[model samples]
Every structure is written in C-alpha cells, then in structure tokens.
Target chain A: MDRFMSLDRRALLAGLAATGVAAGAAALAPRALARTEPGTVLARAIPSSGELVPAVGLGTWITFNVGEDAEARDACVEVVQAFFEGGGRMIDSSPMYGSSQAVIGHALGRLGAAAPFSADKVWISSGSRGPAQIEESRRLWGVSRFDLLQVHNLLSWEEHLETLFAMKAEGRLRYVGITTSEGRRHAEFERIMRAQPLDFVQVTYNPVDREVEERILPLARERGMGVIVNRPFQQGALLRRIGRRPLPPWAAEIGCQSWAQLSLKFILGHETVTCAIPATTSVAHVRENLAAARGALPDAVMRRRIADLFGTL
Target chain B: MSEWWTYALSDFLLFSPRTYYRLFALHNAALWPAHLLALALGLAGVWMLVRPASWHGRALAAGLAAHWLWVAWTFLLVRYATINWGAGYIAAGFVAEAVLLLVLGALGNRIPPATGPGWTGQGGTDMGWPRALGIGLVLFALLLQPLAGPLAGRALAEAELFGMAPDPTVTATLGVLVAAKRIRWEMLAIPLLWCAISGATLWAMEAPDAVLMPAVGVLSLSAALARSFGGRRGTAAG
Candidate 1:
C-alpha cells in the first residue's frame, strides 16, 4: 500500500514536469505527442533488453573534462541539473576524458535518489586492469553497478570484452558493448559486432561524417543492437561553420527551433539510432539538445532533406 | 581486436579549432605582459647574435633558459595541462631543458655555442642572409607573433606572447641560437621535439598555421645542423 502511494505521488510530479515541458515546446514548434510518459517523453527503446532511455544524452569528452576549475565545475553542475530536469538519463563518459567521470558523480550526488541510467566504459590497457578499472568507474560514478559498460575505442577489447561479458553475467553490469570513433578501425569494429554478442555500440556519425551510414548503421539495425551516435555536431565544427545562419522555413514543420535540434533530429530519424550524445558546456544548449529528442522525427525523405540543407551550409 | 598497435597523437584528440584558440586566449589573458618582458629579453639576445662578444653566448643562453622556465610554469603547467593530461609531463621536459641551458650557460667559456659563429672551422659564410633571417625571427617573436592573433581572428587582449607562449618562445630562441657562431646539436633536441609534437597537435586540429610550425622546426634544425660541424671555413666576410 505504501509503495503504491509513492508511485502515485511520483507519477503526479512527472505529469507536472511534462506539462511544463509541453508548454515550453509550444513556443517553438507544432504540438506532437512524445512517445513517453510525462517526463520520459522522448525516450527510445534499447533493442537488446527492451529497456527505454531518453533519445538525447550527454557526452563528457572535452566539454565536461575541465580539470579542477571551480567556475567550470559549477557551470557543469547547472548543465547536469538542466539535463535531468528535461528528462535525460544516459550520461556517457570514460576515464580517458580526465575529470569528467568525477564531475558527473559530483553532479549526480546533488540530485540524490534520482534513477539515472548510468552508462560508463572500461578504458584501460591489458592485464588484470579490466576488473580494477570497472571497479574504479563504479566508485567514481558513486553507483554500485553500471547499466552499460563498453570497451572504449576497442582498446584491449578481446581481454576487456571477456571481462565485461563476465561482469554482465555476474550482474555487476546490465549491458556489455564496444565503441570506436570517427569510423576508424571500422573493419575491426564490424568484425567484433558480428562475432560478439554486444548489447550496445557507439560510433561517430553526424550529418557531415556519414561514412557509418553505409555499413555500420545497417549492421546494427540487422543485429538487433542499440546504437549511440557520437560527434553529432562534429565536435562543434559543423555548428561553428554554420555560425548564426537563419533556420530554414521548413524547420518549424519538423519542430526544430535551433540548428542543434535539426542536426540531432536527423540522426534520430533513422530507426537504428538509440540516442545521440552531444556534449556542450552551455545549459541553454543542453535544453536545445533535449528538445531535439521530443516531438517529431523525420522519415527517410525528410532525413535526406536535412542532409541536403546541411550540405549547402 | 586482431592486432594491438600504439596510438598516434591524433588518436587521442577529437580536436576543435575554436577550442584550441580559446585555450591560447585563456593562457594569454592569464599571463599578460610577461610576454612583453620575454620579448624585450629575446630582442637583446638577438642583438647579441648580430654582434657577439666573448660572454654574449652565455648571456643569450641565460636569457633562453629563463624564457623556457617561464613557458614551463605558465603555459604548460597552468594552461595546457587543463586540457591535455600529457602536458604535465611535457612541462617536466621544458623544466629539464631550462636547467640544462642554465647549467650550460653558467659553466663559462666551455660550451661549444660560446665561440660566435665563425670560430672552430665553422663555415659561417652566407651568414648575411641567415643573419638577416635571424634578426627577423627574433623580432617576430617579440613584435609579430603576438600581433599574429588578429590574422587568426583572435583579439589583441588574447594575444599569446613570445616568452610566455611556447611556439613563439621556442621559435624566437631558435632564431637566435641557430645563428650563434658554433652551433650545439645536442642542445636543440628537446626544443625540436616539442616543435614537432606541437606541430602534430595543431595539424590534427587542422589549424591554419599547422604547416608553418613543423616547417620552421625542420628548417631551423637543418640550418643549425649544416653550420654546427664538419665544414671547412670560407674566406667570405662575416
């Protein structure tokens, strides 16, 4: 009876948050219902476990790796807070990014008891480092277990993959996967995907760098694997190139108020993409990215249209 | 993975040009006017190169040692380390280089670099052009490299200085050191390597001046090597 009462109260609060988000969306685009409950409106389904997660997540590569600076740390705190308040869950990070894991934990600690979909990576060289690194990641995130554990950049993957699979079986991690960036080592990445039973795979794909679209995306779709797209803004190069160009008249037709939303929505329009992790230092940019996850996703035609428009820019 | 391989410098960086320049800006703003003083010292060292005395080489080395130390503390330690973890160790390299230069400078007339260019069987002819080039380089470090910010769309307030910033500091030092009468091949190792590393980093970021960096490093290295040893002296004017 007590559990039931708590669930009801949580639902009520989520409904309020959803209403607020809906009202905010009204200012920007046509009203389309998001495929989620009140707060988790733009969530996507993970193919392996059928677990739902938000379609837009945060990446901590360079944006969140500001070391030991108080002003930067406080600003990151605000970004993380705004991310959660807008229904984001998957906060992806790696130890390669110095100080990002700690900052995420620092931010997570501030919002006690919120169920965050913790997805982290095992980023260490060979030897008995696999387990120790995983333990360190857990300690850093202040969580007992990670929802997803990927082998970062396929470094020592044969050894690390075995360790990750063992941990998943042992219930230390909920999912096991491998990742690579910029389509580098793609042949090897493809071979691993074919051989290993990975639950998730991260690849760098954006409107500009579409090499992954040829094989990797289709392969993930065929293999029932969840895909995470990194470098959605090409590490801010694409946006910087676009500068402050006016958004197209047709952008409102697809519910994109900002170019960030347009770019992310193009990535999400594909059926295989589970999420896109676009890292940003600005809290306002975080809101813009989260909004991309909601409302409308384009069909194949609309997706190509986005490509053409982006190309001309 | 089928085969394990060592990663290159480009592998680690998913770099952005905007962010890279902003790093320079942050560094420049943090350590203002130190660049100016480094420039002044650098000019004096260059002038010494053009007209050398018995103790001028030691004075030049002392000046370079101080500039290298400043770069180690300000740019690498405080600024670059914030973004790149490898910078901390790289700072140690700069410190080591400074100590070596300082010790070499203090040891008095023993160092080979002390005997100004024409001494010890070195063919110092064609020095007119190289000397002119050397003067330009030293002044560039002091006067022009900071001003180069505007060309790159960077503001004057965020201008990186000669003594404080690594590139101009190293470039300017090479400008003078390479012109020193009897060149020292051993002393150029660390600075050249730093130039190469920083060049590769900028290349990975696709910065506009990426080509110029290693070009200068290689050219300076070649010029220094050519004049350092194994050449017969010419009767041409110094």
Candidate 2:
C-alpha cells in the first residue's frame, strides 16, 4: 500500500491536465487516496508480488494494428496519452496482433514516458524460437524488461514456461504466466494453471462470456494468481449488441454512465480479477474505460442484475 | 491434439476493415498520379480485349506483368506488409505471376493460338461462350470492380484500382487468360489462388462483398477447366 500510494502525483496531475480532467471537480484530489474517490484510479495487487497495477488496462488487439500509417500511429499515441491521463498503467499487447507491438513501442517512444506495467506475451509454435520472439517483442516495445510475460493460447506451453520461469528466477521478468482467450482450451489451461507457479492468467470473461467464472477464476483465486480479463466488451461486439437498450436506472448508483462502464464494473467486481483490459481506438473510449476503475464498483446484487439483463438481451 | 482446427477465419484476421481500407487510401495518397496511369493501362488492356489483334495478346500480358510487379512492390511490400504478416507471401505470388507472364507471353511468345474469331470478328475463329465470359470479366475488372468499395460505403479515395491494387490486377489477369485463344491452365493458377485468398480475407473481415472474389474465382476456374477439357475432347474426336 505504501508503494502504491507513492505514485507520482505531479505526473498524475500532468496526465489529468493532458486528458482534460477538470482540476476543480470535487473528487479530483491532489494525491492518490481511496479507490472511491471519483478521480482516483483503482489499483489491485498481483498475488505473487503485491505490486499494485491499475484495475483497467488498455488492450491492443485489432485496435492498434494500424501498420505504418502515420495518422493512425498518432491516434494510437493519443489514446495511450489519454489512458495514462485517466490513471491507467498496464498496457497489454501480443505479437499475434499485427504491428500492434511496434505501434505500442512507437507510442511509448513518442510519449518518452515510462509505462508503469508493460505486459506482453510470447506467441510462437516453436519453443526454440521463444527467446528470439521475446527479444523481438522487447525490441518493439523498446523496454529493457517486461513486467509480465505469458504464453499465448497455451501454444508450446511447456517449453515457453520453462524459459519464462528461468527468466523470472534471473529477475529478468517480473511475472510469468499463461493465457487463453474466448474460452478456448480451458481444460488444458486449467491443467497448466494447477501445476505451474504462475503469477498471472489472462482469460476471456465478461457478462456475456462467463465460462471462466465457473472454474478458472476460482482456480486463480485458490492458487493465488493475478487475474487479467480480456474481451470485456467482446472486442466491441457486446457494447454494440446492448448499446441499443437503455441503461438500468440502478446503474447510476455505481457511477456507470454507459454500458461499457457497467460491463467493466461487473468483470472487476470479481474478487479474483486483478485487471480488465479492453481494447479501444478512441481517446474518449480509452478514458471512459479507465474511468470504470474509479468511483463506485458494482456490488454482487447489481452484478447479478447485469448478468440477468444481458442474458435476456 | 493440434489446436489449429479450433481456430476460425476470424481468428486469423488481425486488423479491422477501417484499417484495411485506410491502407489503400494512404497508398493512393502516397503514390498519387500513378493510379491514373495504372487505370489508363487497364483501359488499354480492356481495349486489347475488344480489338483482338495478334500482337495485342503479348502487349496485354507484358502490361499485366508490369502491373503485377508494381503492385507487389508498392502495395503489398511497402504498404500491406506493415499490417498483415502474410502479405510478404502474397507479394511473392504476384512476383511469380509477373515472372510467368514475362516468360510465357512477353519474351517467349508462348500464348496459345486464338481458338476463335477475334473480338472484332476479323480472325478466322469461332466466338464461344468462354470468350464472352472472359470479355465480361475483363470489363468488370476494369470498369465495375473499383465501384464495389464506394458502393459499399467506402470513400472514393480508398478505391482499389487495377494496376495499383492486387484484387483488380489478378481479376483482370484471370479474365484475359480465360478470354485468350485457349485457356492457359498454368497461368490461371496464381490468379485463381489470389481470388480465394482475397475472398477469404473479406469474409474474415465480415465485409459485405466477401463472396465476390471467390465467386469470380470459382466461375472462371470452372469455365477454363471446362473449356480446356472440351477442346481436348473435340480434337480427340476429330
């Protein structure tokens, strides 16, 4: 808590200014305090290290695959800027997302600021090639070391995990884990999670995709693993589906202005979920996603209500 | 158990339609005025299709070969490769096609003899259904294909032209191959493969025109195969 509370307030203030967070707002405190403070970005601890990371991180899937387009690259830089301004720290990406890792590196280089939690994955079919790919990923991000590294989709998990575990032991990597998305290979994923000493595990879990809630989340909790939730909006498909319907009146109590916030709140409401990474291209959307980590989170009863409502929709 | 089968086409698509279209818009902007020249060259190819001169076949193949090489370097390698990992392989295909065209049509003069009357009805040949289909496809690739993007609500700037983009280039090449005196089955290979790839890409992006390229590919391949076998049977009977 002492380390988490020692966030650079001056930097946070500058970021808020850059993101146009009105200084005069009642909840805009000068220092990091309680999570309920409207301007306060919520931070959760990784079970292994207890290093606090912002509850909502940015995802770079289809959103950041802009290639060498200068205009799109600038827009991505701006999105990252806004994400930081909105009190975001973790920015998650994978090599499978074309050009996304390079784009993230470009954005970071342009920003010339240190990313708080730089999370990445090694996603190759060949175990022998994992080190080269990881080196390439690091080169693309321009980071000396990554905060977290996961085996993507459980591809060559045994070999990759051995390398990652060795790297973690050498203090080259902060955390090592495995990931799967869209509810794929749960049995295999669970097997790895149960056997390996993992620091984090990323899985697809949202109101609409709750297969993880059945076993994976519980297992992560039991094994003291940090949980990262992906596909919170089903890659924007969920919001589009439920965007037509009006938000429930009860949603205002939890400070959710949109369905996106409500969805993030439900996912984060899970005790095991350390962070929810939602990919977005728009600055306003990134800010909005980070804001879900602020103010009030949905309670268990509200989570149930949200799930039930989405089930019918 | 291998997990490859668990993946869907959508899983392989790494970028969105907006990003994909914007690539072309930027490509067109970066290489301005080249599109006009390419379009003019495409127009020349169309004219060759209608005129049916003996030299027109060689000229058309050489022109298409140049366009293929240009698109491979400018669009595929320089532009599309940044966003798509598989684009390098696709560009290699274009290069192979260009090389084939240079060897078979331009330098070697290996285009098969006209099986029927020329489009202008001058050559002593029989105008057949396959030739008509070929002419129709050429016109489509030249005139109508560019409109698909704009019609599907994409901006005019993002329109993919024949010489500048791969889709129309391959489509036009297939049409010319099919419309030739006889179908050169060997030359049809890459273009037909490109059609399937293009169609699959669009389908993965959930684009409305997903079926367009594949449908064109299936139609042209079926026509060329049927014509080739029928021609052999006719010669055998005679």
Candidate 3:
C-alpha cells in the first residue's frame, strides 16, 4: 500500500508539473491557441449581442475552390493558414462554389483546433426538399451546428430560414441569416428582413457598387442585424476601375497599402458592417487583405478621398 | 495600329484594363518586376536553345511546352478572377486563347512538308491560309461556347468546349474534322484521344450536361484509322 501510494503521488506531481509548464507556455504565447494573429484594431460587438469578431474575414468563393486535388488542397491550406496567421476569423463559403465547402472542411480538419470557422450558405435552388439541403450542407461542412446558416441569394429563403430558425431554437445554429448579392432581389431581401427576425444579412457593398448603401445597409442597421459585406472589391472590378491611380497621400494615414486594403477599409468603415469577406487565391493577397482590418479606419474626409479617387475612373 | 497596340499592351501589362489601373495606383508594383524577370528567363532559355548544336528540335519542343504551361496558369488565374466577378465571357476568351495556342503549337511541329506533300523536308511554310482558318474557327468556337446555352437559339452553340456550359459538341466536332484534314491523320488521333479522355473524366465526375459520346466516337475512329494505316504501311515496307 505504501509503494502504491508513493507511485501515485509521483505520477500526480509529474502530471501537475507538465500541466503547469503547458499553462505557462500558453500564457506566454497566446498565439498557440489563436486561429489568426489579432490585428491592431479590436473586434466590435455585433450590436444585438456582445459577440466580438475580427473585422476582416476571408471569402472562399474563388480561392477556396480547390477541385478535389492534392495541389488545390495544399493551396487552400496555405490560404487558410495565412488567413488565420493574419487575424482573419470569419470564412464564408457556399455550395454554389465548386468543392469550396469540401476544401474548407479539409483545411479545417488539417487545422484541427486552430481552425477559425464562420458560416456558409446553402444554395439549393432546384426545388429540392429544404430539410435535405440543410442536412447536406451540415454534412459538407462537417459540423452538427453552424455558426450561421444562410439562404444563398435568398433562394427559398422562407423555407431555409424556417429550418434555420428551428435549428437556432434547438441550439443547433448560433445565428440565422439571409444573403443576397449583385443587388438582384433587393425588394424581396428588404421584405424578408422586415418580416423576419434575422441575426445577419449579407450583401454586396463596395465604393463602385454603392447600390446596397441606399437601402440594404440602413435596413440592416435598423433591424439590428449584423451586415456581412460580400463583393467588397466588386469581384476585382473596383480594383480594375481604380487602375494605375496612385493611392492618394492621405491613404497612408488609414494604413491603405494596396487598393485591396483601401477597398476593404471603405467597407469596414461602415458602422453597420460586421465583416467583409473578400475572396483571394494568393497568400500574399490574404496578408494584404488582413492588414485592412488593422489601424485607424478612414473617417468621413478620407471616405471622400476614396470616393474622389475612384470617381476619376 | 497604335490603338490596337495600346490595347494589347494594356491587356498584357495590366492583366486587364480594370486590374491594370488598380495595381498601378495601389503601389502593388511587384507584378511588373516579376513579369520582366519571367520574360528575361524565357528569352534566355530560347537563346540557349537556339545556340549552335543545341538540339533545336528538342529546344523548340521545350519552349512550346513551357509557353503552354505558362498560358494554362494565366488562363486559370484569369478564369478564377473573371468568373467570380460575373464576367464569364471574358474568362472564356482567355481560356480559349490558351487552348488555341497549345493546339497550334502541338500541330505546328507535325505538319507535313510543303514540297508536294511527300518530300519530308523540314515542314510547310510556317503560316498557311488553310491552317490559319482552321485555327481561327476552332478558337472562335471555343470562345463562343461560353456565351451560348443548351437552351440557346443555335444547335451548334449547344456543344461543350472544355467542360463549360452551352455544349459546343457540334462546332468542336466540325473543328476536329477540319483539324484532321489540315493536320496529319496520325497526329489528329492524339487530340481526339485527349478530348475523349477529358470529356469522359468530366462526365464521370458528374459535371452537368456534358456530352462525351462524340468525343468517344472520334477517339475510336482515330484508333481504327491508326491500326489500319499501320497495317498497310507495314505490308508495303515488307
């Protein structure tokens, strides 16, 4: 009994020492648990709830479409790693994008505990059963409950939103939302927002495409729903429009190094925006994009400068 | 000419008129240097291959291969960029051009000599009207396939090219026929086989609305022709 007690005591002491060392290391290097490096700017509360999220997020529409191959897998891993390293948290993907959700799932699996996940959309417009579509989306993402489950492009929003709402009630989803880009179904989107109690609304709002600013953003704010900006670069069209024009002198003040940053900053500056998801295939581009979330945002004057800069185009 | 040159330069330098201006202004200036370095390396490779007793044929083949690879990379980049932005037609054009260049380069080396078709000299004149027309038609069909749909007005426009929408089967079939006539029968089989494999793979992958039957038929015909031709040539030699 004495020998057994001694051995147990020794084992307990060793376990405690090891745990102490691990805790010390974790305290010293917080990045060990971090999905992404915290940017210079702090996260904002999602007005309705005190949920803090990094202002910059990654979109996997184009970049994350790794077509079920090893090379694509590696590229996605690099992109996800860069996003996580650069303080990006929210990763938006969809079924509309080819194998994007699968790639994101693969990256997350590779990332293990370090993966920073957000939400994705279910784009089942073929009149399939809504519950089946949701189940399939859950399976594709490999998550029992999604951070947010959105109806892509407001397609069968009524049916999907009902399912999402029920899931939310059952604590399967933290938030329920609707998404519509390209300003295609604004009237329907507005009607849904007015009628439903949604936590988020995804829309396209960039400097070049200011159509969303007129109604969608204000409506989102009024409804107390977090607005996720999509196509903040107008799918590279805004960058093309601002072609070859040197960044105005004042752009440096807002930490706008590339037009990508400038464009993202413009979207981030909006008080209504919860996060802007810009798609990029390059790791360098991901780093550049994450930088937009850092430092002081452009005030009203700088916003004018941005507007004027692109106005010349 | 000046306008055309300016547009071409802008397209090449800027990647596109839209992207050129943004990167130009944002001080994201690494692309120019990278492009210059790539161009220098490409030129140096070409020069080295062209040097005396440098295995000109192998060098040419290597250069063509390298060019096609580069084009494919750029094609993917452009397609990825443009597709997300709702500029599908522009993306299709870029990809089609890449495919056209690859096909032309592959076939260019295999054309029989112009000296009465049997002399077996180096080859035909570098550029010929028939070959140019065939290439143009193929490129046009490739580019236009993305614009049409199965539900579109034209029957030929409903064919699949490179697994994009609006199946370009009829036009692609016609193009293959033209290619077979213009190029050697033996050489034509390779492209047919490639198309068949690619189409079959796409079909098997459950890609929507892709027709692989024509491509399979073409490959079978090519294989049959190859076998029969080989038998005849062997008997004659004996």
- Taking all chains together, each candidate's TM-score versus the true structure is 0.79, 0.90, 0.55
Q: What TM-score describes the B chain of model 2?
A: 0.91
Counting only residues 3 or more apart in sequence or on different chains, how many pairs clash (N, Cα, C under 3 Å) in candidate 2? 4
Worst 10 residues of 3 chain A by lDDT: A1-10
Give candidate 3 regions above 4 Å deviation.
A1-39, A126-128, B1-172, B175-238
lDDT of 1 at A123: 80
Give the interface RMSD of each candidate.
Answer: 4.2, 1.2, 12.3
**What docking grade does candidate 3 earn?**
incorrect
Q: Which candidate is the best by TM-score?
A: 2
Q: Which one wins on lDDT? A: 2
RMSD of each: 6.8, 5.4, 17.4
Off by over 4 Å in 2: A1-35, B112-124, B231-238
Worst 10 residues of 3 chain B by lDDT: B8-17
State what share of the real interface contacts each candidate retains: 0.18, 0.76, 0.00
Per-residue error (Å), model 1, residue B174? 0.4
- lDDT per residue for candidate 2 within A233-284, as digits (tens), equals 8888788787678898998988998999989989987767888999999999
Looking at model 1, give its docking quality level. Answer: acceptable
lDDT of each: 0.73, 0.82, 0.55
B-chain TM-score, every candidate? 0.82, 0.91, 0.30
Candidate 1 per-residue C-alpha lDDT over B133-212 given as tens digits, one digit per residue, 9 for 90 to 100: 55567777778777766676666666667787888887776776666554555667787888888788877876666765
